[model samples]
Target: MASVRFNLRLVAQSHWRSVHRWQPKRWLWGRARCCMSSLVGRRVMLTRPASQAQGMAANLAALQAVPILLPVIEIAPLADTSELDNALFALAAYDWLILTSVNGVGAVWDRLAELKVPGLPPALKVAAIGPKTAHGLEQRGIQPDFVPSEYVAEAIYPGLGNVNGKQILLARADIARPALLRLIEQGGGRAVDIAAYRTLPAQADPTGLAELRRGVDVIAFTSPSTVHNFVRLCNGEQLRFPDLPGKPVFAVIGPITAQALADYGVKPDLVAVEYTAEGLVAALLNYFESQPLRNSL
Candidate 1:
């Protein structure tokens, strides 16, 4: 009996080490630590670009949640950067440059760096929709003159203060909404919008369906493109949303993404009030922490 108890203890220790390999702080002083933010057994789906999904997955893992990578869309460089080139070469013409996404910042800066473009004209000011966008510009040694309190274009366009007779350069994805340009023109500003990158649905296998067939807790959509591409893939694969096991909660980044989901006649379970990565994660945590779940799929 004594030897059997000792063997069981050894088995428990080995199992604990294996389970906590990625989570080293699970035990302290022979007591199991409880983290308020842990999502330990939850598997959440992420529908962002493939290249951008890893960072989010790392973040999820930090919260003790499993990140299900479901990259529905990807950003591609525009074949014709001629228009973008013209805008870059004539940078002095624009009074304000607005960058809405990190992809835009990368594409624009890549070309500008290739030409060894000098400092932006003192007369020109730069605007980024959010911190992430600003960080992208900062990496290229440029700082935004302004970032709106809210990350949406609705807030950005109106917050520009006075734009009477000012020329604005809006560099963004090929399929970006034109409302910002319309807003600029409505504010008495002439705008030159250029496509720095093109967004297209990525060709990927619809993985994790078998897991979903069992159940999933949440599916998060980060963009309108992601919403569209995901639904498209589901339809093509004959994977109906209603068939998703457990009636998993659908989390969307912001109002725009939520509206996209609504277009497909599906309502989101949660919409982030703040549109950034941190905001989405917080929303997810808020949801599961307040709700109970079954022990397993």
Candidate 2:
């Protein structure tokens, strides 16, 4: 009986060694499979009619291993359309158009379509803060002339290089932070700010939050509001494995969101080097690679 047990243990050890040898390729395959699985039966919620939720869905699909649970915090129209309309008109006059978020792009695009603004100015150079925002612009047939290597405003600020005397239009949410605008102004550029949309706090979805707490391995936060609202919704609830601070990683898009997590007393385990969904996905994958056994369990 002792000899038989020893033989079984040796076989198991050999099998594990083989698996370890193939770990790198297996990890890559696992990520690919996850991405494909995420897209199989997914439906994108299109809050803004003109919003490129489909494109966003495709982008999400490509990052399947990241485990993003998008419990939309809130979706609302631009509180004021007049200012957006004026901003679109001003777009034609400005030398540059800056888009800070996907929502900002959608709001501005919807307003432009409504007002029948001829076409984006031919000479207007477009700048986007991240790849997703840049993708939003591309879907509208406009290519961004400037996108930062990093997704944060601080990273993007220096890349603006020299915009002295440049007329720039920044289309963004009503409650968006003023970092971008402030940077543009500091660069000697005259910036006209327009509030394209407004984000209202969404009623906490208890059922959804419950499922997330129970099943999700990672939580991806795109903005500070999402983090704040999500935490508020989960207030009083205990996490599945609270003892492990990094068990279910909190992945943030950029420093702003990382700060938001910090403010809520939750430090993110991973933050994307770039502020786009793809970047977020890559960061998550890298984290998994570094901690394969933790992910497997």
Candidate number of the best lDDT: 1
For 40-145, candidate 2 gives per-residue lDDT tens digits of: 2222221112233344344545544322234545657875687778778767679877788788888788888889986686667777776567667767876566
lDDT score of residue 227 within candidate 1: 84
Report model 2's TM-score to 2 decimal places.
0.70
lDDT of 1: 0.76
Q: How many pairs of residues in model 1 come into backbone collision?
A: 0
Residue 174 in model 2: lDDT:
75
Candidate 1 structure quality by residue, lDDT tens digits, 1-297: 323321233354344335522232232211213454646667888878767877667767777777887777888988878899888999888889999999999998888877788656656778888667866766666656667667787778765789989999999998888888998998899989899999998776447555555667788898899888888877877778645766778999899988998998888889986677767776777777778755767
Models 1 onward score TM values of 0.85, 0.70
Candidate 2: clashing pairs of residues: none
- Clashes per model (N, Cα, C within 3 A): 0, 0
Worst 10 residues of 1 by lDDT: 24-33
